[model samples]
Target: MTTAFTYSTTYLLDKSHYIETYEASVPADNSKKVYLIAILLALVGLAVLMLTEINAFVAWFIIALGGLEVFSIRFKKPWWLARQLISKAANTELTLTIDEHGISSKSIHVKSTLAWTDISKIEVTENGWLLYHNDSKNYLSSRALSDEAKAFLTTKTQLINALAI
Candidate 1:
């Protein structure tokens, strides 16, 4: 005889969870990178202008483009979160079901299922777990999962986090 383990939880995704998920997936922005690239492009444009004499106006235009990058820095994480709030992410009701077979998730906007074989990898972050498949991923906050569910994930998905589990 075989016994199966099944667990499910339904909760509303808070703003912080979305922020955490975004932070985990998105690379941290280097504020100086924009300035560095702008400076280099301006220098390169200036050099090419000096060398080839291909329209001095074009070189100045390239230099002028730097202002756009500087302007974009204002739209940072909070700005993104605000947009998300205005759109679909705010107050999303999520239902997560996990069993011996795989994981299933249903939210206000989408529903998805991932078998154990289909889950390529599992990453345990400080705030949550990121379940990665092909091109997309699902985020589960640490608080959303029970200890038993965590153990099951450890066994099934190769989620090895000595400190977390």
Candidate 2:
């Protein structure tokens, strides 16, 4: 069997795609530290409120702080992504190419190529796939690709899986 696989497609990098790509780059942590901390903060605030009797300023402040922490955890990533992309790259036409060597992405705004070695993970999402790598991520949308090309990715995934074993 031939080992060479080359696929190329040009697609729009809109707000939703951008957000999804970057967000997936964050490793899914199963650790409960953050949740525990938030809960502790809330419980402490509740205790203070009960002991202080009838809505003390300090108790309310603690509660609000806990709430703010939870809010930050939920919104921080998308917010940061928007800031990074809002100025110029929020919407653009992106042409992506994948071969035996690496992945190359070109756009009206930017041009760059990420080597295959740079790709740490290939996550198949509902819409397409997320290419997670060192310090950067790339999103591949199925809108602009053919079934053959998508199948080629499946082959690559199998190769990766085999290597993992």
Candidate 3:
């Protein structure tokens, strides 16, 4: 179901981590494009060096500049974690499905089942709920959820607490 949510501290943390992980994992495609351009420029510089009696110092400078561009372009920050955070905020899915197929968004399939038992601990923070998964050090932020969604989650939390009691 479509749920409107607000950004909270937990959401920000999860988003930051997700973005950092994603950024660290994959190099940006733009960097590749820039590297290609740098290589082309270097080739042109080489040709110029061959044709003209370019000063040795100038030739070396050109090559070094091109090399620097290529290096910088090849190494770019990954934004997977930020992407995940934004994706969740942008998405209307309210429930995270955990089943035999693994974790899936509720928007994808209603048949997907989510069990509360999957989480290691659930606690309410200053702004939202922290859902710590059993295996991962990362946590899910319920801060981005709308008031209605928060209420629903609160009830679920209460139910969980009651069961524990």
Candidate 4:
């Protein structure tokens, strides 16, 4: 006979979870590329000013603007985009159940279940797992789960050939 294992947990959403989830889900901005292009533009403008008779003021202005762009990219401050999004439904309660059958979840505004076969992908984040469906994703925080539950989830996701990252 085989024994079945099930795990359940309930927790309220918090700011840190929201920020971490957002960082995991969204790709980093391409600031490096932007900065590189800015440098090239500034160099070209300087060359034109020195080699040709182009207006010195315009050339210098372009160079200064490029420098500013680089500074902005390097020391850019973070906006409240993530905070605003999290605040809208802050402290929302969520419950998750994981069993041999699959995963079932309930939250303030949504309730759904995803079978192992139906899961498109599973991404193991630094502090949680991202369960991907066709058009949506659910984030399950590691803090809410026991160590055994985490191991079970990792094993099941691997058995189903789900991509883990």
Candidate 5:
């Protein structure tokens, strides 16, 4: 089974808009968690060191590590960090094409197009439907699509499935 949908950012964005895709969802909440955890860990470590009266060198090491962790979480480049973390955590492939004209996609071995023959499976998820690729193990998602686009896509998928069967 194969299905296809055309993706274009032009409909959703302005001239300055850029399309960005990650192999995984951006951990929008991770930064806050990082900050909280770092603060707590650093404070706890400092308190323990002070109570235990650990050697200066050991205390410095602990403090330094904690500070480093905090610094990294606070100042690290989010785009680069997102790429690295997402790349490592998710093996899925994602491609996002953005230009003045519109947006396009070619993910999971499926070429970017509006044609229905390019899709394999469409399974609904909490956010949206997961569109599978017939030629590869990778998957693409419809989470970013608007209601109108999703409806259009659903219709296209049904048409494709009908033809395929």
Candidate 6:
């Protein structure tokens, strides 16, 4: 069976969708651990400054900078990266079709097909599916697919071991 759908993409939805899919597929880095270590190191430095009678302002400034660093690492960086990536793409309409043999997609600038063998990974995201090729990725929004189409694609696509991630 073949399943197909079409939808127009917008920057905000696409951006959030991509980020959600990416976070699902890729594991978070050790940056959080690194940030915690940095916080500890900064506190040690602040204590050293106090013991040495260094300027009181400088010691407090180090502690303040460490707090800001922790805040950014925890909250700001992920959104900033999503904005940077999403800004690179132009809004366009997309058509996608999935079948037992392969998948095909078309946007304003590109049309392409990948056989089941060509797909390296497939990940189901919160709002859609992510298809990974050797050098590229494609997103198919669940909102565009009917229940029957979604079932067909899920069953057929899952049969391909090469595509399972």
Best by lDDT: 4
lDDT for each residue of candidate 1 in 77-155, tens digit (9 for 90 to 100): 7777878778774798889999977888899787978787666778877777777777877776767889998878767
Tens digit of per-residue lDDT, candidate 6, span 1-165: 844543232233365555655565555675557598558857866896778688877877787778877776676557665664656343455566665567667766667787768777666777777777788776666766778668866765586544454
TM-score of each: 0.71, 0.64, 0.35, 0.61, 0.38, 0.51
* Evaluation by TM-score, superior candidate among 1 and 5: 1
Q: Total backbone clashes of model 1?
A: 0
Winner on lDDT between 1 and 5 is: 1
lDDT accuracy of residue 154 in candidate 1: 66
User: Given candidate 3, what's the lDDT at residue 110?
Assistant: 38
The candidate 2 region of ten consecutive residues with least summed lDDT is 21-30
CA error at residue 121 for candidate 1, angstroms: 1.7
* TM-score of candidate 6 versus the correct structure, residues matched by position: 0.51
Per residue, candidate 5 scores C-alpha lDDT tens digits across 1-165 of 855544453222211111133223233445466677667667767876788876766766766777888777665555455454544324435455423232356555445532334556554444444455655422235555566676775675576567667
Which parts of model 6 have CA positions greater than 4 angstroms off?
1-34, 40-69, 76-86, 109-114, 132-139, 162-165
lDDT of 2 by residue, 47-129 (tens): 99897676678887888888988877777776777686776766788788878787788987889987766677777876777
- Roughly what TM-score does model 1 have, to 2 decimal places? 0.71
Q: Which residue runs does candidate 2 get wrong by more than 4 Å? A: 1-5, 19-35, 45-61, 73-87, 135-138
Q: Residue 13 error for model 2, in Å?
A: 1.6
Residue lDDT tens for model 3, 79-124: 3333555563543344553222223344432333335676555566
Winner of 5 and 6 under TM-score: 6
lDDT of 4: 0.77
lDDT score of model 1?
0.75
* Winning candidate number (TM-score): 1
What RMSD does each model have against the real structure? 4.5, 4.9, 12.3, 5.6, 10.0, 5.9
